[model samples]
Target: MIFNRVSYGFAAAAAGAFLFFAPAAQAMTKIERVVSPGGIEAWLVREPSVPLIAMEFSFKGGANQDPVGKPGVAYMAAASLDEGAGDLDAKAFQARAERNAVELSFRASRDEVRGSLKVLSDRKAEGFDLLRLALTKPRFDQEPVERIRAQMLTALKRETTSPNEIGSRLWWRTAFPNHPYSLPTNGTLESVPTIVRDDLTGFVSRTLARDNLKVGVVGDIDAKTLGTVLDQVFGALPAKSDLRAVPQARPEAVGKRLEVQLDVPQTVVAFGGSGIPRKDPDFIPAFIVNHILGGGSFSSRLYNEVREKRGLAYSVYSYLLPLDAAALFMGGTQTRADKANEAVGLIEEEIKRLAENGPTEDELEKSKSYLKGSYALNFDTSTKIAGQLVQLQVDDLGIDYWERRNGLIEAVTLDDVKRVARRLLNGGVLFTVVGRTQTAASAKQGG
Candidate 1:
């Protein structure tokens, strides 16, 4: 259910944002690979678009692999890599990267972690070397460790005060319980202080195995040269860990409604339960159903009912989150505390109605067309194509997943949508309300 893939093909940028879409006809996808002596392998795609090159390296068992008592170790390690590697301190590294117009980022999700590099095509060699150093020879110096720790602590403090963060934290804790999926990828306040440099060292040493790594290079590099680059970068890594030995996710406990009272003008409510797991046979159908239900903005039921019709909130929507082990489907909205209860009620009623009836033919058609039309946009640039490659590799989605993705979405039917909706939306749907004490009291008063 790892849903780092959750942000599907959402076009957050206008064509002008990246020099126009370059026409769908010009977009193409092909797979080529290189094998290193260390047994590390990389899949690459050559897109000679902008004078830019991008690569994504994905490692297995991101947050889920955190050892006992060191819940956030994996995430900290990912962040720390860029802080110092070899002779470059954080500042020096940033200077070098900016000087070369390189964008280097490391991010973690429940299932996998990623390190990405994007640079001018002419600077590919230097950028790749820098990335290699960060991966293979990161210098987890103590001074930067303390600085990073304090920064994270401050960020966590701010996040805890936010209503969206409050609801999400509570929901995962209730749903996953003892499971790794239950923990925040970013460590909790209490856990952050306990993570030390040695913790990071041990985690990276144990986790950065050759077989655990997969990379994709896209842009101006061809398969042969990319293979050589992959070897020089990740080729020396140790053997792969026993991947199958990883623990399986436990069944989610039935979640309960929780309300956190703060001083605020609006009440933010998140409602739903464990949805469809990523590897579940019904995942594709569940995704289609979710889009039809609330994922599609103007065309979705939640937008039409909650905003356009009643004007309850500025935004209202539902989404499915498939983690490595568990899936969560949630609908959310922010409204006046007095109207919060009514908003939650409307969301549930609509879910129940869909469970009983299913989407109409028109809704089904629109969702399909939207999904199909969006496929080409996935290859808009090297950065995006590289990212998609890493994700599909991590999911074992097969190299040809992009070629067949549209077909899968097209195969989903109205009956399939109803079946998944009915199967997923059941029991006491967990509801999380975050707002001021007065707002919580008002919502309770109406209840």
Candidate 2:
């Protein structure tokens, strides 16, 4: 009998062991590139010990492809895929999935439409067939489309009063004013209702094509079997996507601050600035620098300064957020309305300090150790491995990135970290504050 679900109850224990005792033993699991008879290619990691399979695939052109007037069409279309497919109605399709003990879902992000499938090895055929149907023959039935659309609209309505959500949305809007990246993934209220079945169908047709697809699979699957499944699942897609080219953009509104006045007791602050891209040669050094500055949990400078030292906020940290079109270094904190300016001031001061002097040699060594030692936690399960593989492909990192990642971090010298720190943190930060703030008047006055 096939296991209905893969359990990771002991994953925490195993991860702990790996982190403490086997840190240096971190090694890349073998990855093989498989090409189908029809020429569909996929990255596969065969793990015969497990009886299940996990596959992740993505197609370029996500919400970024949504037409001028239709911002949420891609997101809605992804949600609609598993609702019904081919000859199966909504209920029947979901019933089939349950009977087969398969998990299938789709998501739309700023740069890609991604899908995930997990099933027992014995039921591979059924799992692949369901995925194929969702990709190539999604029914986009009226009922499912309306149901998902309504749910999204309700969420958007709730976002109006959500300080965190409001702050994040405002940050993006201010950062990428005229760009598609500024558009909400779930879309605005006006755009969700405008989405129709035709729009969903068109999105699938134009975006889900072979040329733009990247796939990664893990667990009890071999190269030969995966090659066959790849073609059976994706061979029917168009040779090329009809996606519009998205131009490169940088985060705007730097050195400016915007405040949305709310009656809430606590104010939420969201801030962002320029960042190094994933493909930049200095990315490894930049990653280390960020860890010492804010990416590290309790050990980071921001956390020590903002929360532990002054007790001005409950939490504060910053990290790199590299997107396909732009890169950003962003951070957030929540504090009492009265202390909002103090929190923002401390954040700015820390950023300036890092840019000016960079991390000390001790700070640099500690960050590299933590980063390298904690890397083993990412591969404690087949699903995690599969997810990492997919992300590596999306970032255009070479197939051997898993093996080389640790070395890259270890090789960053003190000079490299200081250089990247100055490069990334020298830029002005744009701040967006939501909720009651004593600084609101001054912020707006300056803007």
lDDT of 2: 0.83
Query: In candidate 1, how many Å is residue 415 off?
Result: 2.7
All candidates' lDDT scores? 0.73, 0.83
Residue-level lDDT of model 2, residues 293-395, one tens digit each, is 8899899999999999999887888889888889889889999998888999999999999999989999999999999999878776666777788889889
Stretches of candidate 1 exceeding 4 Å from the true structure: 1-26, 36-38, 242-255, 437-447
The residue pairs found clashing in candidate 2 are: none
Worst 10 residues of 2 by lDDT: 1-10
Residues 332-441 of candidate 1 have per-residue lDDT tens digits of 88998777767777887788788788888898888989978977777775667777788787778888777787888888877888777788765447777888533333
Per-prediction RMSD in angstroms? 5.1, 4.6
